[model samples]
Target: MSRALGIYIHVPFCKQKCVYCDFYSLPRREDQMDAYAAALRSQLFETDFSGCEADTVYFGGGTPSYLGPRRLAALLEAVFAACPIAPGAEITLEANPDSAGDPDALSALRRAGFNRVSLGMQSADDGELKSIGRVHTMAQVRSAVEAARKAGFDNLSLDLIYGLPGQDLPRWRKNLSA
Candidate 1:
């Protein structure tokens, strides 16, 4: 029997760099996105998946949602065409609070064969979020969660970061409780 594999596609584009992060991420330049998409497509096309099937497809890092809806759809389309994904494959996209907040964008993702969404919550407290240079508010996270639900996403996931300059154990507990 052949073993099934999982796929992780890294999208190295960010709206802005986080102060603590040193990951290699290119700023989203309008002129460069199309080329990025093309390179991604070319790479996907050139890869051989003859004996293995993909059981899960994860679009991760700098921020997959930074590509927005249509571009993201195109990426998904390419992946689906190039790889043999299982019938019930877990397709996940990592998105920041501000980017995944749009209902239409979520809808587009759903249509593009994504079944899961991992949101970058950062922190529940607005102050904690700001201390890390996150532009979105907790309110935006709430809205994004709501929007994800409305867009028919049941397997929603949230990611949080802890241990900041002013983050105490008590505050961490409070953040989790909220």
Candidate 2:
């Protein structure tokens, strides 16, 4: 029997870089997206995975959502065409609230076979978010979550940062509750 595998697709594009981020990401380079997507698809087709089935397909990076729904859908289509995916596979996309809060986009992504969404919710405090150089606000996070749910995503997760500058126990608790 073939073994199950987890496939991770990285999108190294971001609207802007966070102050504390050390990852290799480019800011506001939308022109390169099409070429990048094509290269990624080519790589997928060139790779040999004859005896394995993908159980999870995770799109992570500068912010997968920054790639936009159409590009993401195209990439996902390529993934399906190139690999043997297991039934009920978990297809997740890592998104920032500012980019992924659109209900129409979320719906399109859901229709494109993405069943899970992981949102970057750095902090509930606007000041903390700003301090971290996050482009999204706490209200955007809330809206994104609501939009994701409305778009038929039942599996939703959030990313949080603790010990941020000026972050205290009370603040952390507030973030948790938020």
lDDT of each: 0.87, 0.95
lDDT of 1 by residue, 1-178 (tens): 5569999998888787777677777765656777998899899999998878899999987888988888889988988899888889999999988888888879888988999999988889888788787878989999999999999999999888878788899988877876
Inter-residue clash pairs, candidate 1: none
Q: lDDT tens digits, residues 4-102, model 2? A: 999999999999999988878989999999999999999999999899999999999999899999999999999999999999999999999999888
In model 1, how many backbone clashes occur?
0
Q: How many steric clashes between backbone atoms does each model show?
A: 0, 0
Worst 10 residues of 2 by lDDT: 19-28
Q: What are the C-alpha RMSDs, in order, of all predicted structures?
A: 1.2, 0.8
Error of 2 at 63 (Å): 1.0
Question: TM-score, each model?
Answer: 0.95, 0.98
Instruction: Please estimate how well model 1 matches the true structure, expressed as its whole-model Cα lDDT.
Output: 0.87
In model 2, how large is the Cα lDDT of residue 38? Answer: 95
